[model samples]
Target: MSYREERRADAAAQAEQNRKAAEARAAQEREDRRLELETKLKAKEIAAEQKRRDAEAKAELARKEAEAKRRQELADKKVRAQEKERQAAARRARFGRVAGWLKANPATLFVAFVMVASIVPAVISQVGALSSAKVHVMLAALLAAMLEGGAWAITFMGKQAEDAGRETRKYRIATWLTAAAAAAVNFWHGLEAYAEHPWVAVVLGGSSLFAIYIWDMKTHGSHGKTREERRQEKARKKHLADRRKHHKEIAEEADRLLSALPFESITEEQAFETAWQIKRGTQPGLSAEIFAQVTGARVQLGAAFELGEHVRPELVRAGMLARLYNPLPGRLAEGIPTLGPSVPVPALQQAPEGATALAGIGVYGSEGASEKACEKASESASGNAGGNGSRGRSDEELEALLPKALKIAAELVAEGNQISGAALSKRLGIRRDDARRLRDRVIAERKLKLVEGQADAAVGA
Candidate 1:
């Protein structure tokens, strides 16, 4: 073979091999693209299935929610219906009770009917349901009904007042006037409605009068009260009188007990403590008046001591001597002269230094001179005799005067008057010491709480 021929054949063979290889490569690429499209289609089907399942779940949830909402609404409706039924039942019961009461009270029922009917004519007129002439007749009927009802009420009231022992003249007069007016109105209306038959007017007027008479007879009969009822009333009055008498006796006893204490021997503090103890120990509680009496006795004793020392020194000295010597004799001889329980005298040994003036019958030399000088100075300072020679008041007398003094003090305090020793002394006609004790007693008893400056202002005023 020629070399050129060989080259050309070899080239043809190479081209054929290249063509076959190119076709094989194109077939493999077409198979790969088909497999990729199948995979994409499968994934798309899977996603569509998942989306449909999600939609079904959402729709089911919504349906369940709607069902729950419907059930709740039904439950609320049932609750409301039950509440309404309960309210209706309560209203029915109340109405039944009212009907029973109205049925029992015929007079009250009649009055209620009249009052309701009185407004009906005006209502009919406003609604344009009645002619002018008919409206006037209705109004006249209403007036007659009102007057008759009023007369009945007044007659009943007068009878009740008379039964209760109250004056009934005014009620009787009102009933008479009302009955007359009712009869006149009824007769006038009857005549206007039935002019041809005069007997009708007379019958209407007579019927109203008869009704009033019947009501009066029913309310106020000849045998109004039985003998048994009268006896019971008398017994009740007697019981009340007995109760009043018992209370008065108890009060008197309490007053006596409160005033029985020897206030002159005890200090104010001791007296108050003893009084509180007695009050607590009392069976039937003590009255405020008893407490007032106790306070008054303490104040009076203190006042007598202070005033007697200055004004009636002789009496004070004699009282001191009696208190001292009387105790000495009892101490010296046991059971000597049997005297009733006497006020205990404080021992001279307990007296503080420089207080020998306070000892009974021991004021000598300078002490006596000082006491005389003090008496003269006080007498000159107070031109008034300081109530000299006046005997000390007994607890009973002091207690009797206490109420007026307390009332005055209360009035002064209520009027914004500051309470002080001086104010009390001047207003209550008491000595300064008595006023001071009274003020202290009131404060201790929680009757008043005066500020510091207020008491000073009261003294200056």
Candidate 2:
């Protein structure tokens, strides 16, 4: 009974211990599964967060790109708009000028053209009926008139530029028709003279034919033409017409300015040359001040020989007073100091050579002889009378006329008086740092004369 009880108790204790160990192992396995599930969920959440952030960043980048594109397009549009506006403004200005020219000289131009076409033919007929010598003279005159008339009509009518080109075409056609008709009439007369009096007609007809050949040759300024040649001729003529119109506008502007300035008398050629020079501004002689005066030009030379009171204002505004002012305009005659005419006083002479040379150098050749004479006389007299005898220019005068400090400094550099930066600084009385800058500037200025060339040496000689 005791052995059976002991065996049963031992088995019970072992069973209980085994059950506890299995329970602990099961608990541990459940905790491990829970931790794995939690770790997987956290990983999924982190991945989702990363994807969301990436999507947000991409959206922001796209928005920025679109904004940049829109801004670029707007800038381009603004630039295009500005360019278009500038072009339109230029066109309107050109048209306005053409309109004004036609309005101002309408009657004169029309009458001139009509007389040229009609009067020429009438005179030729009249002269032919008269003496033989008269006939030749009249024929020559007629030919000249015809050539000039054709050119003027073509040039003006083309520039009369209305919106429609139809009018210009009609005008051109009329000019050609008139030329043909005039030629036909001339041919008919030649034929009639030949038929009526064979001997005299031969001479007259030959003479007329010769005249015709001369006219065509001189007028066309070229050889015979083919179909392609004719097309090119038409294009060239159109180009010439455009040039003439531009010239006409410039001419009209000149006329208006001349009428306003009663003191000085400037020719159309002078005005044109001056205006062109001012506009180009490519030369060192033409400074900013001179350009300003020319661009703002509302004055021109007049028939009046004497300089007007307005000269002061113009010279002052032009910054040319220091160079060209005359002090005798408002001064007393006695105080002005009169010189005896022994060694040819500059004022006594009608013209001097220096003014002419200066004018040529300045490219202002259309200056009136009378104006040049006056200017030369005044300038020479003033320059000489103030300080010296016949030789002119006293030591005091020379000293007074010495170049300014800045001018001296510039001249030294221009003459290549220095090379290195330190040397240049000493020569120019400037700092070493400034000398480097000046050297750079001088190098950039392409036309600055750093050395006295043959031209200067010759001039000095």
Candidate 3:
């Protein structure tokens, strides 16, 4: 064969080898894809199995938790039932204890019974009284209860106070007052409702007082204040009330004193007395400062009396002197307003003829005084100048600003913007007069330039 045919044969073998290699490679890739698909199928099956197992486990857990919750609820119900039984037993025991106490204290039970029985009658009587007065039913009932309840409350408090060995005077007074008011109301009610029978009204009215009286007597008996003692207490209370009314500041001061001292170290009266001494300066009615003023005034009065001893003679002498003088004296004292006003001078007139009083001083050649007067005049003139020396714009500044203002005006005109004296004033920071002058110069130059331009144009033509 030829060399070209050999080269062609070698190239065909290489191409054939490449085609087989590419086919083998494609077959291997197809096998790899089949294995990968099988692996994904197995993984998906495993995941599905895991999800089924997790769902089963969760369902079992929920069933177990439900069973546990059922058992817990049963236990809680049993506990509540047991607790209810225990509470029932406790209530019974408490009721028995109260029954035992009531049985043991028959007298106390009887007293309670009596209180109830008495309360009903008194309350009914007072309520009836109030009802007859045309009060509201609820209000009448409340008022009746208040009167009866208040009286009994005071009576109860008095008993407690007696047991505690405290003063029951206030309680006794309060109870009696409440009882009296209630009795009066009942009396009025009965009298108004049953006008024919006074005894019925008396009985109704006495009913309110009778119960409270019994309670009061039982509570206080002989332990209460004696009549004399009560009178003394009332007098003492009046004295204190008067003191508080008349001297509120002093009463407040006394309270401060009482607070400052140890508890119960002094009585209220003692405290008030001490405060009065301190505040009123140990005087009952008058303060020390006021006393001092009064004494000082007395001393001044005595001094005035002593002065009168000698002043009377002087006064007599003055009267004689006054009588000796004539009413119209020829000579007038200088600078006295009542005597006559000082003479008003005529308009500027030349000094009367010859030598003036001060004229001779000039003839003596008072050069020092003249020099001083001239210096004063010059100083006054300098002072006046300093007082009002606000200078106007200098000629140079005005001239310089005038050129600048004209230039600015020309620019404004070129820009088709108007220029006026006020606008020039701001541009040059000059006075209105200076700005007006500058603006006028600008207008005059403009006219002159215009005229010159016309003349030139005419000449050229």
Candidate 4:
């Protein structure tokens, strides 16, 4: 019984042990599966967190890009707006200037408007009239322009001439003729178009002429000068012509000056005045040769005055104020002093044999009639003038006049004159002593080639 029971119990224990081992293996496998699942879930969670952070960073970058693009677009728009405003301001300034100019010249604008209006219809009419087989339409269209162009060209020339102070009458006439030609063409066309309504032809013809007349009025009407202005203008023109005609030298020099400037900044008169100062040396209307002659005459007068102081002392005592006294043959009544220093008192009559300083003066001719008269009258007039004499000088006069006489003597000698002893005595009617003494002094001091001969024997010998 124990064996059987023991065997069954052992079997039972073995069975139980097998069952417990199976349960333990199943529990360990289940735990291992649970651990693997948990590890996979944590790994997946980590991956998902990293993807979320990446998505957030991508979204932030996109937002910043959008914000930057928006800011750049706003800046570009602002720049465009500023440029548009500047352009608008420039346009306003330009428009304002144009308005100012239009307002300033209303008459000019009106005239220009009328002229343009007149030309357009005239051109169309001309083209219509001439656009047949012979004339091309383009060439015909240019005909009205040619007519108006000629008139305006003449008008322009007239204006330039008026501004330069030139004659504009011919230009005005030419301008009128040219305008009339244009007006005639227009009238012919107008008449052809409206033969029954002549006023329409008149209007078409007068429009072009009227336009040109207004321009002529503007150019030539306001230049009428008053009397004084006209006088000055006439005088200036005459003076200008005279200067050109009479003063050719100055005009040539002025031409040179004007050429140098090339633009003609200086007036002809101004250039002539400068040239006059250069060429004449003196003021205008005076000559250098005449002035020099006047100067020399004054010098000779001074020399005569200086020499008169050395007359004889006896003559001074005899009521002669000057040392020398030789009154004119008839003017002794005026007092010897009253004859004045300016008169050309003849020297005492010299012997007629040789020439004296006064020779060839034409005052006394070669016949010696005046000399004979002087000597004859002096012989009767001495009264009691001096020893041996008619009217004589003292010996004292000779010594005193020597110093002052040198220059006079030198001048006389330079003039081809020689004052000998007899010539001195005869010229002054002085006592022989003083005449010979003074004459010898002059000859020695001036080194003159004069021979003093026997004086009283030498009269016309």
Candidate 5:
């Protein structure tokens, strides 16, 4: 019993041990399989998350690209709109200039209307669209009336302007005659004849209108200025030119007179007395103040009359005043003293050689003439006394007189009067020197030139 029991017990115990070992192995295998499954599941979840992130990045890039495309489209649209506006503005400016030009040229407008109207009727007649002879005649009459009316109106206005003294009556009679002739021709041909020869009527009417235009242009100038205005302008220019020429001549004469003096050989008193004699001979009754002023102007003759280069009138006047008022040291003052008592003058039997030269030089009456001569001179002088005097004239007075003086000068010049400084002095009642200076200033400012042959014509007159 002991041997059998021992063998069985040992086998059972070994079997039990084997069963436990198998159970342990099975649990380990199950745990390893569960771990592998959990690892695979985690790897799949990570891969899905990465795919989601990639899709979101792609969507963001697409959104940015779409926004960029939209902005580009808007910019392009704005550029196109601006270009269109610029083009439209340019077109408007061009049209505006064209309109302004058309407005300024009324003659061109009338011509354009005539051309277009004539063309329309002619085209209709040629196309046989308007077969009515009466219609063509009516159109012809209308065109003829317009042409005749325009011509008549222009002629009537010109005549009225002439009557109003706004224009010279140049071509007024001729213009009326031309207008009447045109009216007569148009009406004499009659409407039915015009319809039969529509083109002939157009030609005749166009020619008459053109003739009127040409006549107007010839008479009134292309700018439509009246003949009187043109004449006045011409006269004004001539006057300024004559004045300039006169001034130049006077300046040259003054230079010549100064050049003839011998200052070095003569004493101051002798030179002064000689100059005074010459001045008195040339311009009798000249006031002491004016003589003093003249002496001051030529003071460059030093203490004696001296030869010098050409000098301006203003400079001469200034020199004379300075010499008389401001004496050098150790020299007698050359101041102009008060006038002596008046003395009876002797009558001259004949005109002096220098009398004519002195005729227009001074504002005072001519001396040493016979009683009758003096009376006659006084009558002529009285009319020009107020005009030719500069004495006591204020600045305002001079300014007020200037326009009228200029107008007279212009008229005189237009009449072929060669206005010398002496003549201007007499006419304006100013000093010869002052006249010279004023003439120069006006000519320069006005940009005038003497007409060719005007001086010869004036001298002859």
Candidate 6:
């Protein structure tokens, strides 16, 4: 405000302006430094995130590659298995074809041989016997006609077999049947010739015998049953048998199936599906893969059934009941010891706690075993059962079960005599260890016999 004060004031004002400018510059510099630090932190975070993303992408690519490789290997394995199965089926088909070819041609060759060797000799003898030698011409004509007929029949049969796509049995039966009829005709012709010419009749009789013997051996001896009888029996059995069995049988047939299932282990659901397939008569035969999966599980599960030292009461009772209900529908004829058709088998047989009997024989044959042995075994099992009967069984139920158990035990004795323990165990799904013990007990108790090993050389060699 004064001269000296004014100069001082001007200096003071300049100083104040300088102070403000310096403070402003300092604040701007601090702000720029803070921004630079923030930028550095953001850049570091972005680099870390980018690295993490790259690592995740790499892991994802590796997983995809591994999955693709696994799929390729599985596909290749399936293809190889199918190819092998196809080759085996082809071999069987070829062998069947060759066998069919041989069967059809043999009869023609046999007829040719007979005509050339025997017929010519007979004709020559007849010619010599002829008063005018014209009989030789007639004999030759007859031989030619017979040979032609044989040729026609052989050709017709071969063609029919090829066209019909049936097995060899039909052709064999037809050939033998026709030969038998022809032999009868030949015999009648011999009888006629005998009235006029005795020598000719002798030749014809010899031919007839040869023909009949060959035909009889071929038709009756080989087959054990006549073709027509077999056909009729099959039809009758089919008519009587429950059609449910047909579904199971058809599904088990080995044709019209391609691939096996794809599973390391099949669940009960899969088994149920398989049963449905069988029941529906849809797929024929399980593939080796499916079978392998099932058998592998079966081995793991081990033997689930028990074996008995004596006869099983349940089977015996069932068999007796079947006998009593003589001519009972479908299953009774099969002679299988099961609960009645109306009875819910699954419910009745659940966890099946009954005696393990000899499983090989039918009911009646089992009933005939030494009654003494049966009585002894039954008394023992019944005694044991009675001791345990405190668990609660009505008198009626016990009475019913005892008779049934006796019948089953008797059946087992008869069955054990016929089949070996191992076969019986396998058939009935019983444990081998249990079967062995039961077999030993039966033998020790005289319910079964143990035949000592015979000298193989003396018996068969």
Consecutive 10-residue window with the lowest summed lDDT within model 1: 356-365
Query: Could you give candidate 3's per-residue lDDT for residues 1-461 as a string of tens digits?
Result: 99999999999998999999989999989989999999999999999999999999999999999999999999999999999999999999999999999888665676566667766877898888778778998999998989988888888898889789899899889988998898888888888878899888888788877777655545547468899999999998998899899999889999999999999999987888888888876634556674565444434432322222223465334334433452322333222222221111220111212111112111111233333333343333322211323354566766777667768877655544334444566666665445545655665566567668778999999
Using lDDT, give the best candidate's number. 3
Clash count, one per candidate = 0, 5, 0, 6, 11, 8
**lDDT computed for candidate 4:** 0.61
TM-score of 4: 0.34
Question: In model 1, what lDDT does residue 279 have?
Answer: 52
lDDT of each: 0.55, 0.47, 0.65, 0.61, 0.50, 0.47
lDDT of 1: 0.55
Q: TM-score for candidate 2, please give it.
A: 0.27
Using all chains and alpha carbons, the TM-scores for the candidates as numbered come to 0.34, 0.27, 0.28, 0.34, 0.32, 0.27
* Candidate 2 lDDT tens digits, 1-461: 69988898888888888889889889889889899999999999999999999999999899999999999999999999999999999899888887887788575456556545554554364345433435466575665456435644654565464334445656545655654554444455555655665465344333323433333333344445888989999998886576458666554555566677664777645665565445544331334664455423212321121222124354233333322342222322113122111112222122222322211111122224324433543443322212333353344533343233234435544543322223334555444334333433433231234233446977899
Clashing pairs in 3: none
Candidate 3 residues lying further than 4 Å off, grouped into runs, are 1-74, 105-113, 127-150, 195-199, 213-461
lDDT of 6 by residue, 21-126 (tens): 9999999899899999999989998988998999999998898899999998999898988888889889988988877876886765575666456534433333
Worst 10 residues of 4 by lDDT: 358-367
How do these models rank on lDDT, best leading? Answer: 3, 4, 1, 5, 6, 2
Off by over 4 Å in 6: 82-150, 154-461
Encode model 1's per-residue lDDT on 386-409: one tens digit a residue.
Answer: 252334344564456566656655
Cα lDDT for residue 46, candidate 6: 94
